[model samples]
Target chain A: MAEKPKVGCARPTGGLVGQPEARQEQQTSQPTKEVRTMIQVGKPAPDFAAPAYHKGEFTSVKLSDHLGKWVVLCFYPGDFTFV
Target chain B: MSVDSVFVHKMWNDHELSKMVKGGVPFPMLSDGGGKVGTAYGVYDEGAGVENRGRFIIDPDGVIQAFEVLTPPVGRHVSETLRQIQAYQLVRKSKGTEATPSGWKPGKMTLKPGPELVGRVWEVWKTSMEAD
Candidate 1:
């Protein structure tokens, strides 16, 4: 007869094993009253302003500034990564 | 949007992107450091400290008309984005009277949606028309 396997001692410990305390603390610290809104079609886009590199010059870009014309916000992982 | 800084964007454009496209990209390469904009757009990955690939097409009224998000491994096509933009523009210009079928391009046939077209789409539109 094969030896009995260790019961409950061979539990897989791949994910969420050591990080639960930090995660729970983070959740408890934040206010539950705040609502998170998801980005949806047919809804007004959340406006933003940030530094940008355009045509060999450094400038700022604001979403609301391009109100009169159509805007395409193309996002990628990073500058050097394949897009 | 991404977590890369403006300096990195400039270097990448100067060294790499310029060879791919003339004068690099025509639009601004925003440096969304700390993922503020990405968080707002729901593309920020908290564990990775970066944003996933995403695109948003905002109409003239500042409302988001369409959006696409993908993982880092897959690449996006500029031609497809342009085609979608053109299709959206045509529909907007027509004031909801016209609708472009799948894979519709400019100069292709468009369907006039109405009560008459409710069930007769097969009669007026064909898959072959998408090539036109």
Candidate 2:
């Protein structure tokens, strides 16, 4: 018998070495209605650091580090799902 | 970027999108497993449990110059994005002196920023556009 995966909290636990279910649990929360405030343009982009899979490895990337260069922050849905 | 973890990103790259891109994607695909970035960007689609395909262009000064948030099932145009970035770069280099016109590209005419060009831009740009 196999154990069920644990749910992840609000932050990443670091690195790429984690169970699929636990890792995915973070983004799979059920949607609810709330007043949504839009992040306005012409303002400083919100900073973030996350484990990014680039080239052939998973490295931590931060938005502040690219301060002196152009940055394109794109967000898509989960991988392996139909777009 | 995908909402999956780095581990899942690796798996998807190694097994899926990598095959199409040959050596693999050239840019960093950040993982937003916790949806914080998406929430901050206001692109998180809570009902669908996924980010709503957001693309933001940030300047070197870290200010967002342009952005687009599209629903899933609509693919983005890489060429248009490239053109936009180039336009932004051109404008930044001009230091508020020039503005990129429609369908503007490198070597294309840029309108000078002044009160004179406001109402009379068509007279100057019409010939250049007809030549193209």
Candidate 3:
């Protein structure tokens, strides 16, 4: 069997790691940025690469890798919270 | 499909989420830890600190064919999603010249878009409906 990929999370508050608690708290309290530009239909989707949980393991997923195939990109708020 | 991290996803799958989601989540549950994906897709709610329920279906060419964002209280219907995928697949196979009607299934009649079809769709479609 292949080795499972490591899973890392964003540290609460701000940047990746080791930010001050105040900063973290500020980040946690800050509202999500209101994105002015919305992706439109009949246009290319924004590309992204991120770790995904799949079949009991961590793996990487990229939007570009699926260029020739159909993709269903679902964005839910959170897990296990009436999702 | 959440802003939760992979770690949270793993934990949830190991515990509560798996039970609530019968047969498991068939596709990958991507982690948008920084909400980059959510922001790009225009579903992230900054004030609420959570993403709305957003679904996008991309065609083989990477163009978004259909997308919808719903409030957190309402859950999406999986069967309708499947039907949409089928409909879009049919249209793609037809080279974008055909379109699926409402509640279209694979075997259902499809419409050809043109000036000739204008204002006469019901007459043409009624024949197929009667056949059904």
**CA shift at B70, candidate 3, in angstroms?**
0.6
Off by over 4 Å in 2: A1-38, B127-132
Better of 1 and 3 by TM-score: 1
A14-81 per-residue lDDT for model 2 (tens digits): 22122234345457553211213536788877666666767876567777778899988787877886
B1-132 per-residue lDDT for model 1 (tens digits): 467876788899899989999989778777776565676677777788888888999999999999998988999887888998899999999999899998689988888988888989889778777664
Stretches > 4 Å off in candidate 1: A1-36, B130-132
The local distance difference test score of each candidate is: 0.74, 0.72, 0.73
The segments of candidate 3 whose C-alpha lies over 4 angstroms from its true place after superposition are A1-35, B20-23, B126-132
Q: What TM-score does each model's chain B reach against the true chain B?
A: 0.93, 0.91, 0.85
lDDT of 2 by residue, B91-111 (tens): 999897989887687788889
Worst 10 residues of 1 chain B by lDDT: B31-40
DockQ, structure candidate 3: 0.45
Ranking by DockQ: 3, 2, 1
Better of 2 and 3 by lDDT: 3
Weakest 10 consecutive residues of candidate 2 chain B by summed lDDT = B123-132
lDDT for each residue of candidate 3 in B71-90, tens digit (9 for 90 to 100): 99899997778888898898
lDDT head-to-head 1 vs 2, winner: 1
TM-score winner between candidates 2 and 3: 2
Q: In order, what is each prediction's RMSD in angstroms? A: 14.7, 7.6, 5.7
